[model samples]
Target: MSPYSHDFETLEDSLFAMNIMILISMALPLLNVLGYFLR
Candidate 1:
């Protein structure tokens, strides 16, 4: 495999991971508010 393709693959993987982290960070605050209301 070419080094360029490998670098692209790594970039894609990191971008996917970053998206997941952003989603979790966004959800956590909403979850906390829900929990507070339910308590």
Candidate 2:
């Protein structure tokens, strides 16, 4: 039970990291478009 809980915690952390990465990936393209329009 303890090991399973530990694994679950790690999985949650990884999922959080993945979400952050996905947001950044999405933002980069939008930022580029904004910059191009501003220029």
Candidate 3:
């Protein structure tokens, strides 16, 4: 019923996607370092 609800939903989706990408980017390097140390 709110006028701005649709825009807010889209913004939240984009923010969620950005967070996922950032987490994957951070995790990849951490995994590489762990693999090196474990090997």
Residues 1-39 of candidate 3: C-alpha lDDT, one tens digit per residue: 686998899999999999999999999999999999999
Report how far residue 12 has shifted in candidate 1, in Å.
0.4
Best by lDDT: 1
Could you tell me which residue pairs clash in candidate 2? Answer: none
Question: What do the candidate models score in CA lDDT, each in turn?
Answer: 1.00, 0.99, 0.97
- In the range 1-39, model 2's lDDT, one tens digit per residue, is 699999999999999999999999999999999999999
Tell me the spans in candidate 2 whose CA falls farther than 4 Å from its real position: none
Model 1 steric clash pairs: none
Q: Candidate 1 residues 1-39, lDDT tens each?
A: 999999999999999999999999999999999999999
lDDT-based ranking, best first?
Answer: 1, 2, 3
RMSD to the hidden true structure, all candidates? 0.7, 1.5, 1.2
Lowest lDDT 10-residue stretch of candidate 2: 1-10
What's the true lDDT of residue 13 in model 2? Answer: 100
